[model samples]
Target: MARIAQESPGAPHILIVGGGYVGMYTALRLQKKLRRELRRGEVRVTIVDPNSYMTYQPFLPEAAAGNISPRHVVVPLRRVLPKCTVRKARVTELNHDEGWAIVQPLAGPPERISYDYLVMAAGAVPRLLPIPGLAEHGISLKTVGEAIHLRNHVLEQLEIAESTDDAELRRKALTFVFVGGGFAGVEAVAELEDMTRDATKYMRKVTPQDLRFILVEAAGRILPEVGPDMGKWTAEQLRGRGIDVKMNTLLESAVDGRIELSDGSSFQAGTLVWNAGVKAAPVVRRGGLPVDEKGRVKGTEYLTIEGLVRAFTAGDNAAIPDLTQEGMYCPPNAQHAVRQAKLLGDNIVRSLRGKTLKPYVHSNVGAVAGLGLHKGVAQTYGFKVKGWPAWFMHRTYHGAKVPTFNRKLRVVADWTLALFLKRETVSLATIEQPRADFQLAALDDVRPKERAADQAREPAA
Candidate 1:
């Protein structure tokens, strides 16, 4: 048990976990709907998340490619939700029976927070498999940090290849392998490919032909969100650019910079990115909530947990039943997560007012994906679009969907600036460990000069 935080005596508290799309949007909606109660001190809205900002995940690929500035893709929670109390903490445990949750603060001890109502929207983590060496070598693109790291890493590889005279070393440095073919994997690879190709123009030794970009998919087709025809077209388009689109293939191993495929082919590559899939965030399962087999919190069509009236869930963490699809839960994607959040917010308000709740039902809106600059694929409103038009649609749709008008304008401004300026391709990998050199210098200063001289003068045994 944890010590309870101080709170207002007469106000009902609504505690929301996670700061992703669902958590941020739901809190935004709830604050707007419950404005009167909040002003009167009848209710208090509190949100707890490890990050102070909500990352718009759909733009991660573009962020990785330097197409959009990383800072513009995330919305600061404090700036957006001034009325709500924002805690930078992770919900470590949930005890709904006692109406309190355990939160681990960013830099301190765990504390207990009692709530009248709870909303779980912690989102998902990368679904990793037991493939050997994957834990050591595999990287993902789930967060802004990861996206920025990947951009730096990809550029670093190009630098290595450009300077290397050994053909094998050059080959290994230039080869990039991406696993999975979903929207994340496809878009990430495509955008990075575009950036890398453009970057090679500045390198004297490296050319587009020298780069090897391989995409491995276990499924027969890629981008299942779009129909099979579009998936096929997308693969063909990738191949047209000299990318190896290996369908129905499995990555047998990526051990020690050596990649082995099920097709009996192997290669040494410096970069290996894994975007296979996502599972519900561990906090959901570990918090003792009732969850489905896939570890998602079990919820009704109204987005409330089965046995708990005050507990609600949405987004990737919740197994929301799809009324339109028989024997299937809603797919854990941005499309469903954003829609469910809107309805979940409204339902929470209705529940507080003692009104009948409405079931969440939204027909599938088709999918759209960017295949680098001036190239994309989209299926919306029973129509299929490809090439530049699809690319424009992708930007337009996501630009509108990205939460907060300020962020939308910033994203638009980034795109506008790109028209006249060349894409920034310099690697800033040092940003990951920005203080290492300073720390080392400080440590060196602390050493005794006489002891250092004695150690240096001593001969090896």
Candidate 2:
């Protein structure tokens, strides 16, 4: 099949198994460092991923709320890594002994890919619990499609509320519950709330007071990484905005349209976004490498697979210990991922040149989290900052870390334009059911109603 490309002759072929922060950055660094070697056919690099683009997940909430254009958040693989071959495929399995990996490409049969050097950067996926009906109704904002879907869904609910007299359904649709209170959950809910509140000016039926925004966290604190005082202030700020901050509350079950919580609250809500945690990609498990207690591959300070020195692993899928923090593994955050990738790239080249590899050890600078417009909480260098300063810090730090200059410029431009323009609240939630209207029209001759009683109490547009 066209999916199977033969390795270049007489060159050391490098295979990158994922196109996430670790995969893209590692390959990007390698191509830059080994450009002359690659041109002379001394080294060949192939980057295989399911998608041709790398998503900047930190900007996803802004994208979902239309604070930033979605296009600006993803860097196309072909554009940045021109010297490296980017293949659109999922690494289904790996064979370290055979020195080849199995790739399942879209629209073709699976094939085996050979390589002299292997980089396992297959990141993590959203962890799902066995909660009932979640698989069917719960929406995720992990990818570009997911973010766009969320944006459209939120706006559609507003439209539905404006057009319908069915108060119960409207209420259900407008009520949004976020399962986790960590970064993704908090950022997503806050940005969405900010956008929806702004959009309420256009709707008579749906007021800012009508929307129910719930932030559910099982732990005692919402932003534990941030200090106690700042975290409490964040909760208070959320409360000031009329968000239901439910800490130490557990979601017992969610099936059909009903939800039951461990706090003994039961209700019906149409929109649910789960951002609780994540699990390592399945590709890492099938790769036949050394993984730790968790499903991540165990890597040395050099990010070399536990015992296999040539193969490297990083990002969320690698269980590299935080040697500084006793009995603790590195928390799978982007801060660590990018740093590990940088080291992984440097170590790979050093190993080839018969140079000593450096150990992976970093003293965490602290954490920063954005909680909607001009509201954030952060902890850095043993100091806490909240409100505007924290929010600014959040943007500044992420702007600096968001990969290539092209992407950085695009993101900065998005933020710059956002300063002057209002957020876009037009959600195309109906896209989820593009054919539902057609089916209804064919079967029952039914179309969506969007009318309200006027002066004469007659149906008016």
Candidate 3:
């Protein structure tokens, strides 16, 4: 068992699990608000997550489309929460009743960590269904790494299609399919299609007409985050750009590169991007905490786990009661995550000082999504905007909310540079398998040596 480093032996220790919006923002707030307590060893905050950085998911589509630099879309936890103890690990189990958790570090065996307070901000994971070949063929877009890989993959497919002499191979390579039509799926397909169209201009064999982009959704309409009218308009705009918007359709199967849709449609696509949905992290279920049917930790209006003491949760992992609406919980989105984090930090500080905890309450601000360059949809405070204005709103809102002036400046600079310069379409697919070349070279050298040794061992003819 490791104590995870506390300055005072008896002082209260806060063990925060996860480094996403909730964990990062909560720790950031604690570090600032409890500066004196942290310095005096009165309270200790320790954060554990597998990654060292927190990725901003809204810009993933843009990053994938080369509109924003992949490096700028993530915030480093160590740099942001200097006052808290950040552990590069994942909590495998928890004993909330005893205030201890089992953490498995990136390279070390599992260790028990005792805490006075536990924050279950472990975030969410891709909600995969039991579909044939889905696991093997489908690519996801939840992390910055995945976003980068998708970008390289999209460009690589174009290269393959352009270079291939076989029409079947070319057709398959040029066809891109995206499952799910929510914000992530719609934006990803739209942005990538836009980028691909621009990329085709630079290719001699590949034209914009030669490429195909298809969006599959199980719902009746796309962009349910916005108003139905706006969603319809967005769908229409997408179709106008030559995209195949197949609503009320599901990806029944994706065996190898063959796609089978629920609507009796079939096709061969080289790229299959899956953005179906996400559920709370599995750790929340394993922790023995009170979780809802969907595996999210049941949170009180105060943002603490129900029927538990000194244990808190919010964000996608918590089904926190929405004070603004009857019988409704806060939606799993960045807006609530950021807002709840502030209150969660304050409540924790109040609890330490024997003050009454305040409940978290916030109204829906609205929703905004970008559909490629100069195209978007937004519904803020009841006002709906589309096209260029909505796109501008999407950038402005996310740009301001992306945390830290450094990242904001970098994102804005990327947008600024895009206005004057042509989008860079170079594909660095080799980065995914960086050691492949080195391994092949080593194998070649060993092959000759092995051949010589075999010849030397054989009897003379």
TM, every model: 0.96, 0.92, 0.97
Q: State the lDDT of candidate 1 residue by residue for 1-461, as single tens digits.
A: 47779989868899999989889989889889988888788989999998999999999999999999999999999999988899999898888888889999977679988999999999999999999878888899999999999999999999998888999999999999999999999999999999999999899999999999999999999999999999999999999998999988998888898999999989899999999999999899878889988889999999998788789999988998899997788888888888888888899899888999999898898999999999999999889999999999999999999988999999999999999999999999888899999999987887788688899999999
Model 2, position 229, has a per-residue lDDT of 79
lDDT of 3 at 164: 81
Cα lDDT, all candidates? 0.92, 0.85, 0.93
* Better lDDT candidate (1, 2): 1
With a 3 Å backbone cut-off (N, CA, C), the pairs that clash in candidate 1 are none
Question: TM-score of the candidate numbered 2?
Answer: 0.92
**TM-score of structure candidate 3:** 0.97
Q: Which ten residues in a row have the lowest lDDT in candidate 3?
A: 1-10
The total of clashing pairs for model 2 equals 3
Q: Which digits, one per residue and each the tens of the lDDT, describe model 2 over residues 150-257?
A: 888888878878898997888888888898988888889988899899999887778999999998999988877776777788888999999999999987777886
Best by TM-score: 3
Choose 2 or 3, whichever is better by TM-score: 3
